[model samples]
Target: MRKPHFELPLHFMLLPPVIIVLIYSYGPILGLVIAFQRYVPAKGISGSEWVGLDQFKYVFSLPDTMNVIMNTLSISVMKLAAGLVVPIAVALMLNEVRKHVFKRLVQTFIYFPYFLSWVLLGGILIDILSPERGVVNAMLGWVGVEPIYFLGDNGWFRYVLVITNEWKEFGFSTIVYLAALTGINPTLYEAAVIDGANRWRQTWHVTLPGIRPIIVLLMTLALGQVLNAGFDQVLNLYSPQVYESGDIIDTMVYRMGLLDAQFSVAAAVGLFKSAISLLLISVAYYLAYRLVHYRIF
Candidate 1:
């Protein structure tokens, strides 16, 4: 009885945050009814006409639907691939550095961009990649090449998105991998060297094997983000000219819901995306548990 009473203050301290989560998170679920209704702002949720599956039908029927789906998949998949490979490569390179000061300086320089918001970076990228009067194009001219509009060009936009996303995130992921590398026993390397293994052989046999679990875990968890094409980044960096290659689900929903005032259809698309994400996340967790013995509990 005394044990329960002793924890009362701790329980009270946790109550406010619990209430906030319930209000902000669960409360919005009521708005999901908009997905099945012809929602009208003037009429509100209670008065909105129930349209059943019509909104979803309209969403799938849109001419942009398949293109949006393809765009989302392409960008996200490329991002995931780069996110995995680039970090591992960088981490391995850093691990080979002998000087602590130089290694820390390089880490700081690369990781600096991870702290910058897309809003700021977008402006910087736009200026640097401007078709005219931009540093990138200026450098291209030094080699007698014509100016290239990186952000506006359709064929190049997706690649730019992937490369830039990696630039901003890979440093952080590299740090993660470096931490994993440190966890590998130094004796493992010694054992490999004792077997006449060289640096490359030791790295291949010991270092990579040590980080394999984290790599697999990251890959499995990334499955849930297949539909996320980075809305903030695309919104800031893209224009109408690149919409053919850059437009994704979240941006499409933004245009439909806010710009076009097609709220019900937007809600339908959002709900559809959420359902798929939930499934993928569940599958990802299950695979993680099976493959790497990873579990939240």
Candidate 2:
């Protein structure tokens, strides 16, 4: 029997990427040590006094922690739901449309928002949703309705964040489902039609089933981010008035650590976020495996 050829040179080619990934990814984790120390940039991490869980205790004892956690969960979950459903709905609608040129044009327009930075998009949202002389308010005024403080009011702030995030991200998710949609065998639809399966039946059985694995994968990935409730969007769009509803873990960390100089406490909060993320991702992966035998690994 002939032995299989081993590509030794290919193994050497892989070393550079491995070295880069280790440096860029794993190297930063060393900073988590600050979570245990009374971290001060001037003192340096090693010179800093070790406080252990004192920072963590302080973080939990604060009134804002629970509220921020709730806000983070609400906003993240809402975004996740909208993020999942909108793309699925859009993909289904697009699949139903036989007009290729019009479909492509719509797709292009929707996808444009995904590339826009939050800084630019935030300004655009402020202008569009501005209470005074804004486009949405102006239209509402014509209908004899009162202008809404979409950004300033706590009640409306979370909703606006979710909607804006969906507008920005759903297109990207739609592209994923669209790719999955194209992979569905055309013969399945033809076969369904021969069996007198109507458009709804054909879609119910064929399209959704074909895309189910991808949907599960996407949902699992999304579940991993149950804590990240749009730092950039919230930071850009929100003011102090809406902080009650809009404050999230990342923003809280920024405020506590960078702005407030509560470095150790901020580090502890960050450490907690990382731990939760890891736990959630593991649970999600296990659930996905049991439900659909899905494994990104």
Candidate 3:
């Protein structure tokens, strides 16, 4: 038999994460049986009534089901688009900064919020967007405009979700692109410069091409998250008034499963989401591997 190149300790180092994946990820899959059952807490999985597709039928029969699905898709798609554009733009902008001190300070400021939990930021946003005395509304009031209910009004809630999602996520993504930018061959830019390519032309031709692989990789990976519309952020920020625009599949599931105790219905939704996500993730990973030679062991 051929001997292994990696040391045994390196293999041992992988055990913790593997064990966590098993415990948290695979273990819960056993509970998916309730999706086919009319689940009851007192009766439990084995004892629960097996209703087959009735729960799913009931879910779809509701007036808000399609609305919830549409809301989720719209919000997630907007977030995905913004997530790509904002981060790539910010990274390119920051790359152009001449002063190292100022550049680093700006990076730090933007990246700081990425570390904050949505729970904390939700409270801050609520206060800032408050129509009564919030900073944003106060500024609007100064401009002789009425205070806008960003979180409450259906008209603005989806956009608010997108903006806030970008604010929280763009920094981390920007850092990824910045690292990719560093990996690009400096000779390419030098060659472009020697050819009399101006800054904008150079960026358009050379810079964007250099980062294309990273962009493709990120875009492909993002496909798997098409259904996940910032559950924690939406949960924290949304209200009944904004449900028309802000209610997503995750929030609906939370309401059904936890709040309303419709465990079977929630399970069906979870199963549906998981199935689609698994398919998407598989396709995304395959595309990334083929396109960018990206992979995870």
Candidate 1 C-alpha lDDT tens digits along 1-297: 464446779989999999999999999898999999999999999999999999999888888899999999999999999999999999999999999999999999999999999999999999999989899999999999999999989999999999999999999999999999999999999999899999999989999999999999999999998899899999999899998999999999999999999999999999999999999999999999999999999
lDDT assessment of candidate 3:
0.94
lDDT of 3 by residue, 136-212 (tens): 99998888999899999999999999998899889999999999999989999999999999999989998999999
lDDT of each: 0.95, 0.92, 0.94
TM-score, cand. 2 vs. native = 0.92
Model 1's C-alpha root-mean-square deviation from the true structure amounts to 1.3
Q: Pick the candidate with the highest TM-score.
A: 1
Worst 10 residues of 1 by lDDT: 1-10
lDDT of 3 at 164: 89
Q: Give per-model TM-scores.
A: 0.97, 0.92, 0.94
Best-to-worst order by lDDT is 1, 3, 2
Worst 10 residues of 3 by lDDT: 2-11
State the lDDT of candidate 2 residue by residue for 1-297, as single tens digits: 999998999999999999999999999789889999988789999899998888888889999999999999999999999998999999999988889999999999999999999999999999999999799999999999999999999989999999989999888889899999999999999999999999899989999999999898889877989999988999999888988999999999999888999888888999999999999999988888887787777
Backbone clashes, each candidate: 0, 0, 0
